[model samples]
Target: MTRPLRVVAAMSGGVDSAVAAARAKEAGHDVTGVHLALSRNPASYRTGARGCCTIEDANDARRAADVIGIPFYVWDLSDRFHEDVVEDFMGEYAAGRTPNPCLRCNEKIKFAAVLDRALALGFDAVATGHYARLRTGDDGLVELHRAIDGGKDQSYVLGVLDQAQLRHSLFPLGDTPKPEVRREAAARGLLVADKPDSHDICFVADGDNAGWLREKLGDRAPNQGGAIVDESGEVLGRHQGTYAFTIGQRKGLRLGRPAPDGRPRFVLDIEPVSGTVTVGPREHLAVDGLTGIRPRWCGTVPGTLDGPGVTVQLRAHGEEHRAVVRVTGEKSAQTVEIDLLDPAYGIAPGQAAVVYDGGRVVGSATISATRRAAVSAR
Candidate 1:
């Protein structure tokens, strides 16, 4: 028999969240539905099922709570979201790095801010629809794991959660598939059962990330225009802004002339200060290792790891790479060094490297530097 708990359901007004809230209630827990108001001007975000934290989504959440027969409320975290997620996103781009805002939101907003408030309000736990699983490890600590539905597993983004956050978190949809979740939602009379999943960056309504950055970054942009150079230091083209490009970007280079060999060129490096975008062959983009900073462990942090079971995910929904991970420095200054057994291409700094021990999530870190593969293009 399971003990009933007073849970706060972080409803995003989507099918998964609504279903999660209902399931928490059905499990004999005292559940309260709360929708996070992330944007101050919700109208600026996407309106339909393609967006999240919008005005329509809030209304949908309220209606879902009604159907679930639970008390509902909305919490305004707009300022926090803007500072921690939005501002950080702009900063990362301006610094010539590709960051995952969804991962940051999970770390800073969803789990940190919301969970803190829930605990202060006397809630025993916070429930959400994130497709990840929680399990008791041999050491008796809670471990984060990949969901049964691999296609929908979100453990990579959630790798930021620490031991305390995992303790009071509940993912009710981990064992079920997406189709089953929607079907269950319909059976529960939830109106958002068939709503399409939100895609792209929610704040970027038009899905034009570069254009949006240009509009918002105004004075903060590194340069209005800069030279695009090749390996030989030849100025191949010019770019409007360094923020518009990322490492491994293949298309949109619009180089005035093709390479002498006629092979395709890819963005190999970006120097924000100099506003220099470096283009090269695809083979030059391979990286054999990376150093990650600000490592966030799900449970206890390991000092050193070198085993066949150890794997690392460099991007969300990306395939894992066998790695030898080493933890260095103390607490706040700690860094993770990962040596990938297989060279990976298009890996960028500011991306997260979620380390896993088989199906269990050990931790995650923000990639700060990478060591290029020694091999040259044939």
Candidate 2:
């Protein structure tokens, strides 16, 4: 029998988290529920069911803890959230790259900060509702893998975690599907059972990335307006800001003119300093290789980078691409070079390229550069 552990459950006022905490308690673990206060003024954050880490979410989490018969407390991590996740996000956009803030939050806040605090407070592990499976490998190392429910697998974001973090983390709801979790939440008398799943960037409030960036960046924004150019250096249109566009974006270009070949155009590149937004045919967005920096390994550091059967995931919900990975540099300067056997479209810098050996997560790296597929525009 496994020993009972003192676990801190991170309740996000969502059905999954509530059910996870309840399951942990049921498993004979000493569990305490804690809600993260991510927003300085939660009032300005999203209300209703749209986004999480709001004032309403904290209350909901407290209520769920009450029902689960566990002690609950709110940890004020607004300052950390702002500096790590929020600021990093703004800075990435300003640098003309697309970063996954969720990945950063998991790396810096949830695992790094929260796990550090939990260990300091005598907790054996910090449990969350993340849908990723953990198992002890033959080498006695803990491995992170995809959840049984493929549709809800979140191992991609969690690929940032290292061996120590995985050892001290618990995900009780990984094997169960989302529907079963909701039903279990209802059975446990948790009020958040019917709460809608949070969507988009939690801090973005409204879904308008451009408008929100414009407001936050203010005078600090690169340019109020810039020229949108095609691959041939022909100016297609003007955009309010380069931060407003991302690679592979087809909508909202407002180009006002179609391509010479009458083909729909997509954003090809973003140059923040020059305030240049490049647009071209969709074929131009295909990338065959990428250079990834800041590699974070989950378990054993892979020695054979050119081995077969390696796959990489570039987006949160994106499909896996078979690739050959090579590691270069040393320590903090180490970078990964991936040659994708299957070309991916619109892959952008600052995005995470999660490496997976089958279902098990090996590690992840931040995409720094991409090699576009050879193609000539019409």
Candidate 3:
């Protein structure tokens, strides 16, 4: 006989999450719902089908919990969220690194802080509406897999989850499609069934990160005008701020001059100390090798690959590429040397590199440096 697991569902007041919480109950888990108040100001939530972390979201989560017949509570995590996510976000940008706020939230807040709180409070596991599947392997290890709906798969955001977090986490909507989850929510009489998904960062009120940082960081937002240079150290133009540019960005470079070959220019590197944003032809963006630091593995320590056997995902919605990865660092400060079978463009530092073996998540790490193919200036 299976014992009923005591679970805490992290409700986000969205259709998918509402359905996930209900599914937890259906699975015979002794479930309770909790809404995280990530914003200090309750009314800061954008009006009409936009934004997250609003008082309305908390209320909707409570209502969903009512429909699920589970006890619900709203926890004020605004301070912690600001310190861990918002500040880290600004800090990364200030240091000339592009950081993914969602990935940080999942790693620090959702899985680490919330999961820890749940276990301390006697709950066995923390459940959410993330679109990722879990399977128990023959070795009794829980493996993370891509969701059934490839379009809605959230494994990219969830690749930050370590083995401990994966062990105590639940994702009920992984095997279900997004539409089916919405239908389940409607069938269960949850009002959030039709609530629009919050696609923007929860704390960013206007969805303009650059603008928001300017207001918050004030003179510290890296908005100082900087020189735009080419690989040969030739000054091509000037930019308002290095933060405004990312690797592979071309459109907004506003470079009055074009390359000698009349080809487009792309951002190749960013040097914050010197306030320089480097640009080059599109070919210069190609990087054949990458070294990743600050690593996290799902299960086993990575072994050498003889061929392009492993898959590497560089961006959230980006295509997976075949690569050969070699692990080369110690336990806590782990690193990996990845040799892409094909040239990967726009690979940047501070961006996470998630590895997979087929559909299962193998591990993840932060990109530290790149081995770019040299390009002759035209």
Candidate 4:
């Protein structure tokens, strides 16, 4: 019989993590639950609320651990969270870029910081409730694959994991659907069996990041006012802050004049330096190619410029578009180019472009540029 492995499961006090701990225990592994303390705000907690990393969440994790018959602890990582996740989120927004804080949390907090801490504490592997799977390839290499529940697959957000991290991570819930997870939690008598899934940014419990940023960066919001123009450079209206908008946004631009064709205008670009919010028809947002930097691969695939064709996801919950990936530069400093099979809309710089071969994740990178083909004149 194989010996039981000591596993540290990151519990967010949600049904997923609670069931994950129970599943690990059922698999005969020695399990421990750890909840991250991600924020310093005292009012961040609501009784029986479904926000990750809150005091209430920590207590719920403790209760789940009790049911699973394992030890549990709360790790105070607020300082690092502030530095890596929160600060970056604010900086990206201020620069007129939409940032994915969950991706940052997965990269810095869960995989890097918490994994290091777990290893130092004598655990053989760290587990999470993420809806993704890790498997050993025929070549004895670790590979990341999409979870069985396609609707809940979180591989896009986790595409930043490197080979080393993938080797020591376990996602026991990947093969199970969310409904079954809840059933398992109930069968195990876990208190979080019916807990609502936490959807808002865990640290920003109130989902008021712009409001929070307004408070933290009072009067520091970019004020370089510029024209909101159309494709022909005709000024449509004025905008207060370009940082408040993102690519492909349609509403909130109080343009006084109607379009010549009576169509709604969408945000085409946000120029931070000039503080301009460019608006145009929806077709202007489509792009055919994307270039990104600092690529990270989870499997043993060679990190080279030329590769077989793969599918790329440009945003969370976005459709997977067929593409060809090419890497450039030395391993230490690399850039990736992805030529899409079909034009993708709302391709934004600073967003992640995760590549996949069918269900298996190939790698991912931060988008640096997006190129669109010029439409031929009729």
Candidate 5:
């Protein structure tokens, strides 16, 4: 019989995690469940009708742990979470860039904080319900892979994991579909089996990010509202706040009149300093290349200066584009240049460009600039 492996699984009081714990135990591992206390006021957020991270979730986790005969503990990580994830989120929004808090959470909280704590407590591995897989290659290097359940695959959000962290991580739910996880939870009589998944940003549970920012930052600076213009600088309509809009957004512009060409208009650019929201035909939004800053390679594999071709995912659900990656520095500072195969629309700065090689994730970098073919000459 195989020896039991000591594993600490992060339990979010969801069905997937409950089933993950069950699977880990079924695989003959000594499992301990941990619930990360990320928010000081979890009750304020409505995670569907179920509420979020409330006392109820902790109780449910404890009950599941009891059923599984594994010990359960809650770790208060609210301070770290706020500093690493929440503050960065607000800072990005204030800087006129859209930030993926989930990515930040995975990079800073899950892999860094939780993994660190688990190691300090003498656990051999840290596990989570994230829909991503890890594989040990012939070279003995750990590779991050897309989950078997492609529909729920979450590798994009976990692009920042280094090889060491991946080596000591387990994703028991990676091979199971969401429905199957729920079924497993039910089979084990776990109370979270039918519990609805938390959809909103765990911290900003209300889905009103702008409102949350307003409360935190007070009144925003009053920049003169200006025209939503076309590529030729032709004025289309007025806007309230450039920060409130994003690229490819078509609604709520409140244009006073219809376009002469009768085609729908979409926001193409947001100039925060000028408070200009530029709107135009959809074609104007396409771009073929993006430059990323602070590039981080997942493994110790030094990035090549000669550049290598890779598949780049610019957004969470965005389609992958063929690109070539070139690293520009050594040591603490590095930049990545990605040359795309085809023009991508609505590319936003401060978003992550997750690079993937086949099913294995390479690494990710922050989008700092974009180059449109038309504007490059100028």
Candidate 6:
């Protein structure tokens, strides 16, 4: 609520985070920079200064802290990250679901685990370089908002933040444009000023998820051995495993039977138990509605959201769709049902379905299941 508050700047050894910590310090906050060592072996995580989990990143973070004239420390969060984010990622894929590790990290790591530790250590808040804004809502409470720059709006990824996390978080890059942040980093003499932006999944350093999963899971990997099937339970071909297929994935099916229209077939379903990968035309991926498990509301979910005002975001950088959410059940069984106004494709399970009320993120939920709109491939 005031400047000069004790804050921990979570530096990622990139220009954005470097500039973020610098901004927090410049604003008179007693900022202490901390770099999270998220890999079991830093050297083998991701080579070069291009990735967040690399040793170069840690060094860059320390260098940034030096330039900012603040104390910096490297915290080993590898164990927690492995348990919460990495393990969960493998588990989801094993179950024929696609999980967003970034969202998981935001929910379980940066905000939950790290915030708990920071609070216990007497830090008022954790500041990051995420492109998001915090403003007092019409209800007079702090609320998360999309960044002013629509292109860099990371509200979708940060949609996992709940009321408590939002209150104790600061995003200094919220109002600053991407280019401006780089310029600021350059002006401040931060060593990471020219570092490349990290992309893909940080933990999956090589970007080869299938190969990585195979190595990690061994015999348990989904693509290790499976059969390719059709909608009617007819086996079309043989496959290595089913985890390699996701909803709306058409390119890698390698199916011989093409539709009458000669259009390529797409992966429609993944039956992990049967070790069966279902293939169908693109229309089969259309979903009527989705049920999200473990809903995390950003602020508060109104009691009665009967129709169409609810906006459902299925991907981190995808378009929002109109829907209606009904908060059902209670406790661990709590879930939300979203009925889309128009059918959407690629509604994969285990992916997050973040809900929004206007420009503000109202809440988010992990898609546990989807009710597909029936389609006849013949």
What are the root-mean-square deviations of the candidates from the true structure over C-alphas? 1.2, 1.4, 2.0, 2.2, 3.1, 2.1
- Which of 2 and 4 is the better model by lDDT? 2
Top candidate, metric lDDT: 1
TM-scores of the candidates in the order shown: 0.98, 0.97, 0.94, 0.93, 0.90, 0.94
lDDT of 3 by residue, 1-378 (tens): 257899999998888888888888998999999999888776745566657888788888899999789999988888999999989988887888878889999999999889889999999999999999988888888899999999999998898887888999889999988888888778889998878887776677666776777677768865587899988999888876677777888878887988988989998899876789999888888888889888887787777753544788998888888889999757876779988876789888888989888889888888888899666665
- lDDT of each structure? 0.92, 0.91, 0.85, 0.82, 0.79, 0.84
Worst 10 residues of 4 by lDDT: 300-309
**Candidate 5 wrongly placed segments (more than 4 Å):** 1-3, 44-51, 220-228, 232-240, 302-309, 373-378
Error of 2 at 297 (Å): 0.3
User: Model 4 over residues 175-234: C-alpha lDDT tens digits?
Assistant: 998899888888889878888887766666666665566666556777635689988888
Q: What is the clash tally of candidate 2? A: 0
lDDT (tens digit, per residue) of candidate 6 on 179-213: 88888888988777777788888877767787788
- Residue 143, candidate 4: Cα error in Å is 0.4
Model 6 residue runs over 4 Å out of place are 44-50, 221-223, 306-309, 374-378
Tens digits of per-residue lDDT for model 2, 247-271: 9999999988888778899999999
The full ranking of all candidates by lDDT, starting with the best, is 1, 2, 3, 6, 4, 5
Comparing 3 and 4 on lDDT, the stronger one: 3
Model 5 / residue 270 / CA error / Å: 1.8
Clashes of 5: 0
Task: Tell me the lDDT of candidate 6.
Answer: 0.84
